[model samples]
Target: MASALRRARAGEGPVLAWPLACGSTVAERTRAVDFAQGVLRVEVPDVGWRKELQSFAPQYLAVINRYVGESVKRIEFILAGQQLADRADKNGRSTRV
Candidate 1:
C-alpha cells in the first residue's frame, strides 16, 4: 500500500521535491514529508532537533505554503518508527529478527 502511494507521488512534480530542496535542517533530519496528507511529519531524533523545528515552524510553513499553494497550518513532529528502523540499519543493526 505504501509503495503504491510512493510510486504515485513520485509522478507528481514539486509537491514532494520542493520540501526536500528547501526544507530546513530540522525538516531534512526528520522523515520525508507526506504531501498528499498536507503534513510535514518530522521524526524528532532528539529534543534538540524538535526544539529547532518548533522555533522555525513559521518560516518553514511559509516555504511549504509557497509550493503547496495552501498554508500548511500544522507541522507534526514525532518519533516515526520507520525512520528509527532505517537508522538502525544504517548503524549496522538488523531490523529483522
Candidate 2:
C-alpha cells in the first residue's frame, strides 16, 4: 500500500499540501500522521497546543475537506512524542522512557 504521504500526493490531499495552503507557523509544530476513515491524525507539540488547536479543527477540517473534496471528516490531534512511540509500538519496536 502506498504511504499516507504518497496517497495524499496522489489524491492531492492535505497531508503534504496543508503546509502550502496553511501558514508555515501553523504547520511548523504540527504534523500529519495519518488520514483514514475520514479522520486526519495530527501531531502537535503538547496539551496546551492541542487544546488551542482543537478549536481550529473545524476550520481546518473544512479547508482540508474542501481541498481534498471532503476526504477528511475530522482532525485528531496527538502529542508529537506520543505519536512517535505509538508508531514505534505499531512497528513492534520497544519504546523506552
What's the CA error at residue 24 for candidate 1, in Å? 6.8
Clashing pairs in 2: none
Candidate 1 has a TM-score of 0.51
Per model, how many backbone clashes are there?
Answer: 0, 0
Q: What is candidate 2's lDDT per residue for 7-57, written digit by digit as tens?
A: 555434657656644568979988887766777788888999999989978
For candidate 2, what is the lDDT? 0.72
Q: Can you write out model 1's per-residue Cα lDDT over 25-91, one digit (the tens) per residue?
A: 5445665434435556656677776777778767766655554433356666656576667668889
User: What local lDDT does model 2 show for residue 10?
Assistant: 42
Give the Å error, residue 32, model 2.
Answer: 1.2
The residue ranges of model 2 lying beyond 4 angstroms of the native Cα positions read: 1-12, 88-97
> lDDT of all the models against the reference?
0.55, 0.72
